[model samples]
Every structure is written in C-alpha cells, then in structure tokens.
Target: MSPATSRGPKTPVDPNAPGPMLRYQSNLPKLPVPRLELTLQRYLQSVRPLLSDEDYHRTEQAVREFEAPGGLGQQLQQRLVARAKDPKIVNWMEDWWLDQAYMGYRDPVVVYVSYFFAFKEDKFRTVPAKRAAAITTAALEFKRQVVENTLEPEYAKGEPLCMDSYKYMFNNCRIPKKPSDVAGMYDPFKNTHIVAIRKNKFYIVETVHNGQQLSTNELEQQFQQVIDNAGHIPALPIGALTAENRDKWTEDREILLAAHPENKAVLEKIETASFVVCLDDSSPVDRDQLSRACWHGDGRNRFFDKPVQFIVFENGKAGFMGEHSCMDGTATCRLNEFVCDGLNRNKINHGSEQVRSGLPAPQQLQFQVNDKVEKAVAEAEQHFDELIGKYDLTVLAYQAFGKNLIKKFKCSPDAFAQMVIQLGYYKMFGVSRPTYESGQTRKFQRGRTETSRTVSNESVAFVKAMENPRLPNEVKVAAFRAATKSQGAYMSAAVNAHGVDRHLFGLKNCLRPNEPKPALFTDPAFAYSQHWFLSTSQLTSEHFAGYGWGPVVSDGFGVAYMIKNEALQFNVACLKDLVVGGKTYKNAAYHLKQCLEDAANELRDMLIADMPAQAKL
Candidate 1:
C-alpha cells in the first residue's frame, strides 16, 4: 500500500465503534469563511503578476472601495459567515460550488468535464477476458469495502479527509435533467450486476449469482460470453446520446422513453448497475493512443454518465474514466490506487477456480428506437466526432529524476513540479499567464477543492532569472527556492480553507439578484486573473501509466503530471490549432511536451551546480 493509504499501527476496536471510513466525519470542521480583509489582500497579491501596471492600479482602486468600512464586501462577508454558522448547514459553499462548477454547466461531459487515468500494463494477464475479470474482481473487493464502510479513511499530515464522496463512487450515475443534472445512487446491496459494452452493445453481467459473488473464472466466462454475443456488428449506438450537449440529450432522452414502454426499464438497468466495464475492440499500442482511448473513446461504445467506468481494450490494456459531478479526483484516485495495488500484489481473493455449471448467459440490454430516436443518435455521433477531433493529447514520461531528487534539494516535490510547469509555459510564450493547481479541502466537512494560484510574483522572478543567460547558477537557485517556498505557503493556506477563490466565490454568490454589481467583480483584471491558461494538477501512483483531462479554456493547456520515485510524467492536452496573438500553433501539445522536458533539465542542472561538492554524491 502507498504511505498515504497505509495504517501504520493496529488498534483495538470496540464492536459499537463507527466504521473506519467515516469515523471522524461527524467531527470534521466546517469550511470557514475567510475574513474579508485577508481575502482581498491575498487576491491582490495573486493578480499582480498577471496584470499590467495600469490595470493593477485600477484593480487596486476597485478593491479599496469594495473593502472600505460599511462597504459591499463587508456586507457579503457577514452573510457568508451567518450561513457558515448555521447549524443546519454542513458546509457553506458546498451546494453553490456544485451547481456552478458542475451540475449547471451545459456542456458535454466527455471532453469538457470528465477525466481519465491510464493504468500500467498487467504482464501476467494479457488475454482481454482474463484482464477484465481480474480488474472486476479487484474492483468488487473495493466495492465491498466501500459499501460496508470498512475501508480506512485517507490522511494527509495525520488528519483524516472527508470520505463522504465515496458513497457516490459506486452504484451511482449522473442523470441528465433540464436545468441541471442530478446524481442517482442505487442501493449498493441490491445492485450487484455490472454493465459491459462491446461493439456498441450493452449487456448485463451479474457479479453475484445465486446469492454468492461470481469467482474470477466464472466472471471471465461471462465476459467471454458478452464478447461473443455482441458479435462483429455494431448496434445503433444509443449510448452516443450521452455525449451530446446537456439540453439536447435531455430532450432526446424523453423521446427515447416515449418511443417504447421498455426503454425506461432498460435505462434503469444501466444506471442502477454497480458500474461499467467497456470491452473495446481496438488495440492502442502507443502512449498517445492509449491515452486517447481512455480519455474519450469512439463515442459509440461508452455510457459516459456512469461515475466509474473501467475500460479494457483488445490488447488487454485498461484504464478508468470518471464523471466529475459528485466528487473530486482524490476520492477516485484512492480507489484506483487500491485496485492497482491489490492486483499487483496478488492479494485479491479470486474465490474458487471451478466454474459453475449451467450458468445463465449475460442479458443484452436492448433499446427500442423510432425514427426520431434514430436521427438523434446519428446526430450525436457526428457531433461527438467533430467535437473530439479538435483536441490533441501528448504524454512525456520523464525518467531523468523525480521526488527522490527533489527531496534532496530540500523542497516539496509538488511545489517543485509546479515550478517546472511555470518555467515551461514561460519558455514557450515568453511570459507567464494565470495558472491553477487544485488544492484538496477535504479536511473540512463536505469539502471539495480550492484554487492554489500558481503564477505568483516569486514564480515569475524565478522563471525570468532562468531565462537570462547572464544570471549565475546561485542566483537562479535562490529565486527557485523562494518560488517553491511561496508556492508551499499558499498551498498550505489553500488546503486550510483560507484561499482567495472559494471565499470570493461565496461572497459573490451572496449578492441578491436585485443588488448592484460590485466594482471589484466588474473589473476586467478580476476575470483575467481567474482565467487559467495552464490548468494543472497532480495525482501520482506507480501503477498509473498516464492521467489527464481536457483544458478548461479554449486556448489553454491541461497539464496533468505525476511525480514518481524515479521519474516524472506529464500529460498535455490542448486544441490542435491554438491561435495566440494572431499566430496559429499546430501540434501545440507536442511543443509543450518539449518545453516541459527542457525546463526540467534546466532546473535540475541549476540545482546540481549550486549543491555542495560533497553532497553531490
């Protein structure tokens, strides 16, 4: 087990004690509403590097007026504090953040909101059915722990994180509604079947048969049956509707229900399943191909709204896709890590090898369609193809050095990696833009994430120093240390629920519909400062080959990285034709990959030159 998930020592447990997973949940502190003065001060400090001198002055004036005594800022802060102090409210910003950040958004989830994790190869199980069965067995073990609440809660720096999100991790699916989407959670005890998709066809494979969970060999037999029953021909691709725009899909879903009396039951079967396993027919050989396959497959073979989908390809390569509505990546990361770790260690119980005789065949989920439904599916397929064709993804598996070397320099590995990203952006664009690194706020009740603003003044200074040919190694190293220090401090503040973004978000949401807009919010610099040119985050695991998501903005790059013991991995995603300053940059993902490699090399060289001669060994 990874250190983060490992329980160091055993302790006696009382029979009446709460489950280990949620033992501390009731006692977790509520997310705090930061003081108005501190928020504005930090806000100004964060935007300084992203704004020009004139813009900075105007923004400063707006902030000054907003935070004056008896001003609007103070009023909104009071309302937020009152909401936080309410006994009925667990977390002040939880509902609003969910609505604004996820549910209310009308875009398709495939390229816009979903994320993927590419798993390392399983050398011992290369056969597709065997690989799928092993994954399903391990995943069901995890599901058992989660359903029974027996899993240990994750910790960072000795404090337990919120495990509330795990309830949505299994037997859950996102339902498309008109104004906003809602999450549906089925009873885990009752929903013991999984839906497997192959050649655009869906099948129901019961994980539990005759009141007992199927053995690995039985599960493999069921999967093989699904593959054979699906045949070589593709179905009508009803699942493609899931990848269409929210409103469009919402309307078409109603049509589907009205077209046939059996459609609703069929849909319910998929939504209430324990999870999804996609048996892809195509084999992806390279890192890029594998990432694309995992990220967003040919839109036909996926039911995109399922919270957890394990995708297995023809070559036995596998990965996972996550819907972002109900939980953040941390919860799913732990689950995936657990799955990988258990399988790699050969610790999962596969049950008896003897296959049960006279087992039932996998049930095919058939959707009856009319002319309108058929037209909708066709349009959805075309739109999905067009939408996905515009983006590019590239992976850089840097084996030069990683967390081991960063620790030798006496720096936080995450902060150091953030600098590597900043330096890479500066190298390509010749200037720094606004950047966002996700900071988990799970220490607070019902918490999700806070923005750790990455483009600080200190970071700017460090990048510029590295760019200067005349700068000495000692000077560059000094700047780098200062930058990492600044990053570490801000990240600490962010995780503690004192970051500028969420606090400001709460205050902004506090405004009544009829109230006048605040000058601080109307300022152009305010929006620009939050526009993430580099949307970056890190989730590391030795069992992961790659992890990534689409960029938040059209012209930006989504840079997801991993800092392993002896290597660093970066997965970059952006538009294929990214236009900046009237210049069209093709293959932007490849360029960013090269820039990241160069920046990593330069930073390592500078740090090594500054090290003491005896310490170099």
Candidate 2:
C-alpha cells in the first residue's frame, strides 16, 4: 500500500457513479488545493501528443504571414515603437493557440450556473444558462504579459513589442477545416470546425478602449447623451469613441469575402465556421448612428441577460458569450464589481462630446520588458533552431504521472510536484526513476522553432482532502508533516526559485547574475506517509474543464482539479476514441482509481509503523 488511499471512507458507500445514497461523510473540512491541480494539472503546462506534418506546414505558413509587408506584424512593430496598434490579429492568433496547444482547452466549458435576474418588466425571467470562459489565461495574458515581463529579454534587442511573443504564432497551425468536414456530429467529445467569415473589409469595424468598458447598446443610445453631457462608448474605455466619427471597414458582402485572402487552405477552414455572432433576435446591434460617425459597425441563442450567459446546445453541447476584453475568469466570478464599475457608474451620462478629432488617442502606459530573460528565451529558441538543423524530428510532446499511476507515493503535494518535474525531464531525455509512478515530468522536442504544439488538457479533478473525522490525530500529523515539509523544502529550493524568478522578471529584479540559482537538483527519496480524508455532495461541478475549438471529435479532452479532502483528486477526460480501448473510458478511470488506492494503502501502513504506539481503531 502506498499510504494515501482510503480504507472504505470510514462509512460504507460505493465508488462508482450515482444511484442510491449512503452516508460516508459530509460537511467535513478539506485540503487546500483541489485534486485537479495535483493530478491532471500540476500548474505549469501539460504534455501533448506528437504533431503531424500537416500541422507543421500550416503552422510554418502562419509564421511567414506574420512577416507580411504592412501586415499585422508591421502594425504591431510600429505600435511598440510609438507608431501604430492592432490587437485584433494578435487576439485572433491567441485564440488559435488555445485551439491547438491547449488542444482547444480554450473552448467553452459548459457551466450550468443558477441565477435569477430582476426583469425590466418587473418579472424576474430567471433561466439556467450555459457559460464558458477561457481556461488558458496564459494565452489571453500572452501579449500583455510578454509586454510586461519576458519579451525584450528573450527577443533581439530593438525588436518591436509587436513581435515580442512571436512564439505564440506557431499556435495557429491546423489545416483550416470546412464545416462540411464536421457537420451535425460535433458532440461534446469533439471541437473546432470551418470558420465562416465575410470578406468585406469595409464592413469590418474595430474600437479600442483607454480606461473603461464600452457597452455598444448604451453607446448607441448615449451618442447624443455624451454629446449632451461629456461622451464615449457607454461601456467602453474612457477614450470616448462615438460612432458618428467612425467608418465601417466594409459595405458590400462581395468586398468582405474578397478582402480575406484565401490560399487553397484558408478558404477551406471557414467553410463551416460562422462569423462572431452579434445579433439579438430582433436586429443587428449597431451604434454607428451616434457621434460624428467616425466608424460604422453591426451584428445569438436564447442566452441569458446577465454578463455571464450560458447556452446548452443539443446533446451536452454548450457555449459562453462574455463581453469582457479586460476582465479575466477571476474577475468574472465577482459580477457585482463589474456591474458597478462597468455599467451603473457611467450609463448614458457620457458619449460623443469626448470624441477625438483625428488620428486616435495616444496609447496609455506600456512597460519595458527585461533584457536578460529575453536573451535566455532567444537562446532557447536558438537551441530549438539548431536542433532542427541536426535532427529531422517532426513532433514533440511531454507526459507526467498522475495519482493513479503512482502506487506507493508518500502522497505529499510537494512530492507529487517534484514527480511532475521528473516527468518533464524524462520526456525530453527518456529517463525516469524506479518510483516513476510517484509522478514524473516528461517533454518531447521535435520542432525547428519553439512551437511544439498544444492540445486540450484533460482529466484533472480538484476535490478537497482531509475532511473526514474518523482519521486519527497521529495519521493527520504524519500526513501533514510529510506533505508540508516536502512542499516547503521544494518551495524554498533552487530550481523552483529559478522558476519563480524566471516567471517574476516583470515585477521587479529579484536575482542578480552569478548568484546561486535555486534548484531541486534531484527527486527526493523518503519513507514519509501522506494521506487525506475529504467530503463530497450529491453533485459536483468540476472547475476549468473543456477543450479548445478544433475539427473532428477525435480531438477533445477535459480535466478538473479540486480537493476531495486531505487527498487531491485529478479527474482526466478525453475523447472516447483517443483512449487505448476501442471506446472504453473505463481504461483511464480504472487506471487512476487503482493507482490512487494502492498509494493510499502503502502510506497508511508506513505512518502506522512510524508511530511510537500502534494508532488503530
């Protein structure tokens, strides 16, 4: 026995799916982090399958396009140098990365949140809506973060912030699919389809914010109000941009379609995909009639009226439409703050009177990234570039052991984390320890550039631990001491310190050159026991679960990380097709359960032996 498994949860019940109930435990306390983090997600990044040749060529093409003359790259470069700005293509590219690397983990994770809204007609038309948010804050935060921290250090000196995180562009590779390639069968197990878009560039429109959220509906109505008072987009950034002064990017559908360049590939990708839906049952939401008419604009489901709208498509399909460009998932949970700051404070009281006359408002403060880390990143890129010359490998990937895989783990979170680091090391070099089941980090390197690939991260369960009352004080002490001690030691060690420093560059310089760089050097070998007791309800909704949008059901996965109690629960999921069996999910589920049970038993015995007196029931 590994020392962390439960001895039947103190009270009798079953381990399989829901049916009749039995009282094991409830309303018990829990371990801090959820099972998802410990198992499916160790937090940094996860391993993915090897990339196909088709994937590489499409990706390489995107890298070249970024170099297009007077194109997005140039626009971004100009912006960094105080000349121009473009967040559209940048944002779009990121959305693509979420599609691939995170394996569409960026796709909407259908959340059925219960809410009752007070209706304008005085009747609360409360409805249960499906909601989704970006699971990869890393992708959304890429541009801003690179700008804030690691870019200048890894990038060549003098390179534009426009190209700072160019590493992200490789994320756009995927031979664009036609909707026909995947119609009607896009079940929960699948993601992505052909993207449909109107090429009329003139009809395309954009608006930037300076300091506030711009509500389009409110902006349209308040064009006169802002003119009547001091103007802007009612829900937009403070840099008031009324529609009268704005111009529609296109007018004719022909131009819109023609405007988007087509290769034999891109033309195919949008065949099934639809444009970003912007219409509300009755009409297109257009706010251009107000202000000086600088730009013109226009364009769902029976969604919700609240900021967090959820939609449950047929057969477990779901989607989320969030109007937040600046807010993150953390901020989304705090809806009241957004309401106060985004809507109420500046309703129709403002609009057109504040519109800029020419060019556009000067950008707000932009940070200067560090030079050293940029150098290191450039070095890493160069390493991959050099490797490409020496080897013809086409795909790269990494894998880490999960709770079920390790039968005899002491089961401390710190030890589990160290095991992940080891896995990453093993993937890159094909080396793993005898106790590999304890958790090991692995990485596969098979690219010319740093764009290895991304896929949906799945099967992370985050159930709280240590919430049971039957567990003795001695058992509690043994588990707590081992887990905490290991966590603190790793937290204080050098390798983790390097990670902390490498990741913390933008905030303030903490490490000086030639200083002892922190490290964990080697995985720990010990006889400490770690285990936990947890609590559960009749139903549980996993947090941060879903894949990125992609074509074919063959490419979907989901993971939830939460605490079950003293033990961490990581529930991993993938397309039934992707698993080893012809279509049996039980393979993965049983693998995890058996692996966890073994580890728990071993740890319990170890702790019992370590006690001064036999601690038993």
Candidate 3:
C-alpha cells in the first residue's frame, strides 16, 4: 500500500461533488467515550508489567474504590457522555485536548514540539535552486488541491478518516500568546506568495505572478535572486526569537511591534504566506546531519511557527519541518508524500520554461531593529544555541530485513517493529518501562491520536525470555507471538478511540474544581505508566531518509521509526546529558541504535530457527 493511502474498501462518491475532501465529515461518528468498566479493566492490564506485586495491590484497591457502584468514576463518565452528546460539540475531547496537549504548553516549538522529515536525495535536481523550485512547485500543487477542496479523503478499514486538519496545512501560522497560543489562518485566495529564508534574511517569493502561478523556471530564478541578494554575511537573525520560550517570545513580540509601526505589516506578510522555504547554506552529508538540520536548523533561519517549511540545503539536500500545534503528523505526512512522490514520478506540472517579463522582484522583509530588538535577537540566538546543543539525534537505517521478512513470520509489521523497540530498550536497561506508540484516531470527527502503550505483560515476558540464555527457541517464539498479539490488540483499541490514556484524560478533565480527587487519578502507578520512557511513533515512506521529534520527557528517548520493504529506519533522540536511575547515559542515541540492530537480528534468527519451513518465504 502507498504510505499516504490507508487501507479501506472503496466508497463511491459523485464525481461532481463540490467538497470531496469534506463530503463524509457530517456523517462521521463522534469520538466515543469508552465504558468506565472497560477502561478500568484495560488500565489495570496496561500497568501490570510496570508495577510490583505490592504496587499492583494498591492500584487494584484504587481502581476498586474509583469504580465502586455510584462512585466518582461513574460520575465522571456521566459528565463525559453528556458532553459527547452535545449538539454543538463535534468531538468532546477536541477543545480540551488541543488546549492541554498543544496550545497550552508553553515550550519553544523548535526542539520541543516540532518534528522533521529528511527526504531521500533527488538525483535529477542537484542544484539548491533547482531542488527548491521543484519542491515549491510540487507543494503548491498540493496546496491548490487542498484549497479547492478537491483532494480525496483518506480512508482506514473501509471508512473515511477526518479531513478537517488539512485546513491548517497552508497559509496558517501559530501565534504566541500569554496563556495559550492561537492558530492564525489567512484566506488561501489572498495568500499568493511564500516566505523564503536565506542567511538569516527573509524574502517574499511570489508563487503567483501575472495572474498565473509561477513556473518551475520562474521559481528557480526567484530563489536564485534571493540567494544572490542575501549576500555572504548573515543578518541580525530576528527569526531566532521564535525559538525562545513561549512567554519570552510573546513579550519580545510586543517589543518588536512597539519598536516600529511597519513591523506589524512585516509579521503579517510572513504569517499570511502560503508556506516557508528555507534555503540553508549548510551541506549535510549523512542521515544524522540531515535529520538534525531538518529537525532544528541553526534555529536562526527558521520561523518555527509556520505549519509547513521546506528546507533546502546548499548541497541540494531537502527536507521538511512541521509545526505540531494545529495538525498531527498524518496530515503533514500525506502532504510530504504527495510532494515527493509527485516529483519522483514526474507527475507535477513544471509549467513553461519561459520567465515572464516584468516579474516582480523578491521582496525582502526588513525588520526595524532598535537597541532593544537587537538585544532580544542576540539573547534568542544564544538561548537557541544552548537549547539545541543539549540534544543528540542518531538515525539507524538497518538493512538486514524489514516488513517483507516480518510478514513471513505471520506478524503485523507495526507490532513487530514495536517489539523491536521494546527488546532494544530491554537490552539497554534490563527492564521494560512505559512506552508510547501513537495510533491515529482520524476515523472519528476531528480526531487526532491516542496513546498505544507498548509495554505489556506479554511484551515483558518476551523480552525477559530473549534475555535468558536458558530459554528454548520454541518458548521464545511463543512469547514473541503473544507479545505481538497483545500489542496489536491495544493498538486496535487506541485507533478506535477506546484506549486507556485519553479516556482517563477525559474523566480527569470532567472533575470539578471543588470535587474530591479520586484515588485512581492520584495513584503512583498511574503517573509512572504514562511517563513514556520510550516515546515511539511510525510514519513510513520510501522517499524519507529520516524523521523524528524531541523526547516528551527529559529522561526519555523520542524514537521515530519507519518500516520500509527492505530496511528499518530508526531516529533516536534524547538529551546529550541523559541521566536515568542515577547513571548518566553518554551517547545514548548511539547505544540505542546498536541495541536495535542486535534485537532485529536476534528476532529474525529465532524465527528462522524455530518456525516451520512452510512459513518461511
């Protein structure tokens, strides 16, 4: 299956429909609130592997008291169900989840909340301008389809996924605010240009010129002009202020606006642009370097709030950085897949080669820098350097085997990958910890994601068996099968919006300020189980060299993986000074990469030795 397309039976629609992207949206079901008993039961099962016997007993007592007949759990459940049935609310958890999970979080988005995708090299376009132009043209075509609402909706399991998040994909920017950020969406019809950053200088590159969209050659000319005009020296790095803490940026923004009247207009031009293209001067030679560059480049030549930014390096290497506030990875993944696939297939229209006469010169966005503004910029740059310097990221492209081999073992590819991560962590730490694998919840209206807890009793058993030298091959194989089965079950529940985490989150949100807190909410196991020591997610594409995000917790590792046909790609990210259990993990990302490779080989070897010959492909 194409990475962009989900598995689903075809649902016929009229060819002449006006809003194909949103046709089924009204008929889509609302996100359901799972039954209280089922949620409690699953919650206990999820935490079983991470708790001791005594801790387990206490958790059991907590669950019992919380779910006792006519208890607080039932009251919270009632409130959640009532909210779900509200006619005005499309999804009961939408507003609260957005606020609590994203907008309300005040960290700098660059290294904390944003994510990146390093594209596979494009052999045909080796020049930076050529590559940037091609990427821009392809992305603009995608924007056109989205703006016209003619893009076909994605499907999973014979049902259409929600297409609502696509609205935030273009001409949108996340604005800094005091309490919570707000998403600003400009009218697509009015935003005819895109912002381009080079040498810490910003330029307005008009995508549409002379009442027509610019051709690939025209875009190349414009990008080249911007590059040439930017000169060799870097500018004041005003964009670095966006990489500061949310509150700091919010304050600095006011100072910037107060510094000059025209500053507002300059900000508006950037905020309202269709998207951003960063023409970076660095040449990244390897996967690690590319991933880092795309993840958070210099942190000065980037406006991190833009929802979509295509970064092109001086060596013609290109990748994409996505803002995580308004949309999830699935939406941006599709957008990127469309761009790369379209370009690779030569399907995108490059337009006429002729550059039209009297084309408007690229407009440089000049910020009025006063003493205060310059000081703010300098501080931002220093802070950005300090913040990014503390994190290390490594990409492991394991070519031993991938989905093709895993399928021969009768395993779900994703489940097998999850086990690989589990075993890798076990090999390093000698125990399983809380692990989170993101599952898409787009089957429901305005859906985003739910946590698929990966560490289970079965997984613990499997990992332990693998670690034990005395374990027989048959026993180890059986344990592996059971672990994958358990992982698949929880993942199914998560994607269906019946997982433990979000349901518990909703129940907690339903609690009144004056109400007594339930023991279940205050349980130590509850907090520990959700700590997510290994934060993992998968978004695969053959065209991607690497993709990842920063860890959610300071001590945890953010593991983003891709399972390709012949290889598995893992991007492990964590703090450089990682300390867990009083022991500092120097070069943790590199250690995890080695563990992953060993685990993959061990699993393959065990299956080959124990499984029946007929099962082998």
Candidate 4:
C-alpha cells in the first residue's frame, strides 16, 4: 500500500543480512613503468616533506628506504602489491589515486585522513523549487541575448583521456556528502563506503569485513549480500550480475552474464552495486571552531585544512562548508546532486551516463587564461577609474599568488570604515540606468465583477554618459541611451481579456520575482574568504569540473574550498587538524573585508565624478 521501495530486479535478500560474507582479490592495473624522473635522494625529498615529523631518526629511515640497493623500484610493499592487484577493482582504484595525487604519492598524511562525514540537511528550503525551475527556463531562453564568452576552446589534448581514464569514478564513485571523508588518507579496513554526484547517483562498495583480504568468490558473495540488503535503486535499475557468465567476456568488462549463460551468479555478484537517497543541503560550519581543526604538528603555524567542513549549529541543525581544498565550482555541483540524492533517498537507478568520465590520463592545463584575464584587467582601467586605485592591489595580488603558493601576505591590520552606496539615475538633470522590466505581482484577484487581470509594474534604469577619448560631450547621453536600449524588450502581451471584457496580463522580468532581492549594500565580512562558496558545494552545472583538497587532520572540519569557473563545484570533508581562527585566513581576513568595501565604494564615487557635466549641451 505504501509506495513500493525500488530495488529494481536484483535478487532480493533479507533486509537483515544473514550468513557469512565472502572474500575476493582484485587484479590491479599495471603502474606506468618508472623512468626515474629524479634521483633517489630527490625523490626522498619530495616524499619526505609529506611526513611532517622531521625527527632525524625517522627522516634517516625514509632516506634509507629511498636508497635501497635496487632502488625503491616500485618494490611496493609486498603485501601492498598483492592486495592492490584485483584487476577489476584495482584498476579503478589506481585512477582514483591519480586524481588525488596532487599532494604526493604514498603520503600517509593524506591517505588516512578520509574516514567520515556528517549527515547533510537541506538549508535553502525557503526557495520554491518549482518556481525556480520555471524562472531558470525563462532566463535560459534568453539564450539569444547571452553569448558563450569562452576564454579558450581547447586547453590540452589529453584532457579527454584524463576524463576517460576514470570512467569508474563516473560509474562507481559519487562525491560523498563530504569528499574529505574519503580523501587525503584511506584505510584499507573500512567496511561500507559510498561516493556520489548528489541527488543523482550513489555508488556503494561494501568491503569484506575484518582484516582479511577477499577473493573473487568471497567478493562476489558479499556483493550479492549488499544487493540483497540495500533495497532496490528505483531509477538506477541495478544490474543483477548474478547471472553467472558476466566474467567470461574475452574482450574486457562486458556484463559477464551477457557472454556466458551458466556463470551468472559470479558475474552478478560483482554487478551488485546499489544506490541510496539524495543529500539536500549546503550550509556554513562555525568558522572559529573549524580553524582549530586543521593544524600542522609541533607548533608549526601553517596548517593544511582539508578544504571542507561539517558542523551542527547549537540548535541541533546540521550545516557544512566546502573547504576550498578538495573541490571547486566545477566539481561541487556534481557533488551537491549526489548529496541531494542521499538526503531524498534517491538512487542511481540510472547510470552516471551524463558526466565527463573524469581525467582519463595525464594532461596539461590551459595556462593562457591568465593572459586573457590580463587583457580584461588592462581594459578595465581605461573604462572605469576604479582600476586606477586597484591597479596596484589587483596586479600585485595576482602576481604574488603566481610567484609564491605558500606565502601568506597579510593585509594591513589598521581599521577603516568601508561601504557601497547606490543612487538611481535620472533623466535631464541626473544619471540614467538600463531598464529591463522590474517588479512582481502583489496578489492575484478572482471575482466575477473584478477585472480578469492584475498588473504590477515599475520602470527604473541607470544612464551615465561619459566622454570618450575621441567623441564629443554632446553625443555622450544619446550614445549611452542607445546602447542601453539595444537590449530589446522580452515580454509581448495580447489582450486575452478582449473576448471576456477584462485585460489578462503576463509579465516577464530579467530579474525574477521571489528570487534573492538585489541589495546595494553587501554585508561587511572578509572579501567572502573565497571560501564562502564552500558551503554551496557541488557548484558544477554542465560545463566544467573543479576540485581541490589539503592533506591534514582536523577535528573541527577546518579547511574549505570553492570554485566558480562557470557553474560551481565544492566539497566539505572533515579532518583532525585544522582549527578555526587559525592563521590561514583569519590572520588578515577582517582587514581584507574592509579593503574590498572601501574599494568598491571608492570606485562608485569616481564614476559619479567622471560623468559628463552637461548632457546634450
């Protein structure tokens, strides 16, 4: 009678899993043959720094490991090599490790950090989703007005390869409610683990419990146990690899049963992946508390926070911040969808068919973006004097970051008031602003005698005529108005009420009704920490993939990351070291916040002063 839970065709198991789980060995992909890019000592230098403890004894031990007679020579720990060899599973695991290898290979500090995540609760519940969707459709339809405005088309050739290399991530992995829970450090002993795209798909992997490694048969049985227990994934349409012959494919991983008929159970065992509901929210953690969670050991001032955090407010409400480390805008949206699915009990009945497979292989990044942005930066100065004052600050910061990734450049601590003020433009005597229909319906009325339509309208625009280098003052106002008017009208109405004897109204505005209203004065806080966007994890939409992370411990869910290339991507996984009010951002956070406000307001005043004194004179 209740809505049937969707497990979708997989053989059912008792909700209460019964009996012993099996064990299995996974064959791993071959690592690229080592060509020795650097000397043993240098390689040791690279991996040594990863271990924060600099005790001469431990450092000496590592150096010896590096200098072993035949070279560390991928003499991967014998047990590790053996355990990492399950081809089907290990191949995917290798690709996952590549995506996460930015910190260092074999860095235990980064590996063991990914263990947990808090439940994510939806926070933006106030917005009416149905209405928001409608508005999105309308805005996107203005496709004719907006341009692609891409900076470059192809940054690297191997990008697709890199994307394809990790098809497993696209298929079997989902960004968790917090990526840090699975990032940095990994424990080979954990039982059940999940990854996701939030509200889209959830990939579940139940490892054979205890310290014993699994054999393919054991793994197959355990996978079945999961299918028997995890409930059906509605849209996921989980495959019943249990049909026995799935593994007989001579050509690689085709559904084993599709090839051979009798071995269905063994193949189906591996195909037994399941999905859960979507997670539905992004919210900030306590800034102060989180800073304390990500700290380097031995009183060191620098702390590598795990780019994301999760915390419960005093009211027992759960919230999280996507630390800027593990994810960027491009990566966050995919994650947000995964979390949403978990919160909503949504499952990937459908495969991860829509997304990029992830970096399939090694590739280069487009370093030219800086050049294009540089041109834009230069032009900004000529059009708006705001750049004149910022010429020093903007250029300096950009260059500083380029030169030193680790240095912290603290702003002046001196206090100063900052703000932004808006003044509406007027015709003839004052300035004018561009107008795109603005307003909303106050209320709807329905009565036999009352008019069939209720109208709400307000028209306001800003117009500023500035003297061009070659153009005369007399043409300024007219030129400005013409430029603004070029943006044509969007709404056209016909009198539907003509036959009914009353006017029927339909209105469309560029700025949607019920959306966050535009406020001239922004809240004074740090220049939004670049991490404010962290709480809005899974920022990606359709175009790009963004992600980042730090290799450190955090008891307070410290490090946070955010990316906003096109859509948005972000993640907030916990760590044991980063703590709130730590030096990373807190050192000069308040100072920068003040500077940004002052900077914007100062630019505004400059614009007013630069306007032509007499329009059409």
Candidate 4 per-residue lDDT, tens place, 1-617, comes to 01223532122322332211100001111221112222223223322222335543454464454336664323332223343344443221233333342222222222223221223333432222221222122212221111121111111111100111111211122112112223332221231222111111223333223432232233333333333333433221111111011121111123222444543443222222211111222222433222222111111111112232222222223322232223332222334334444334433222223323221211111112233333332332232232111111100011111101111111110100000111111221132211111111101100011111111111111123331235443454344333223211111111111111111000001123554422211211111111111111112122112122322322111112222222111222332222333423322222322433343333234333445555212
| lDDT of all predictions | 0.92, 0.23, 0.93, 0.23
Off by over 4 Å in 3: 1-18, 614-617
* Stretches of model 4 off by over 4 angstroms after superposition: 1-43, 47-61, 70-127, 131-158, 164-552, 555-558, 563-617
Residue 467 displacement (Å), model 2: 16
lDDT of 3 by residue, 305-376 (tens): 999999999999999999998899999999999999999999999999898988999999999979999999
Clashing pairs in 3: 8-158
Writing each residue's lDDT as its tens digit, candidate 1 over 195-258 gives 9999999999999888989999999999999999999999999999999999899999999999
How many residue pairs in model 3 have overlapping backbones?
1
Alpha-carbon RMSD to native, per candidate: 2.0, 23.3, 1.8, 28.3
lDDT of 1: 0.92
For each candidate in turn, the TM-score is 0.98, 0.26, 0.98, 0.25
Q: What is the lDDT, from 0 to 100, of the residue 410 in candidate 2?
A: 40
* Candidate 3 lDDT trough over 10 residues, lowest sum: 1-10
lDDT of 2: 0.23
lDDT of 3: 0.93
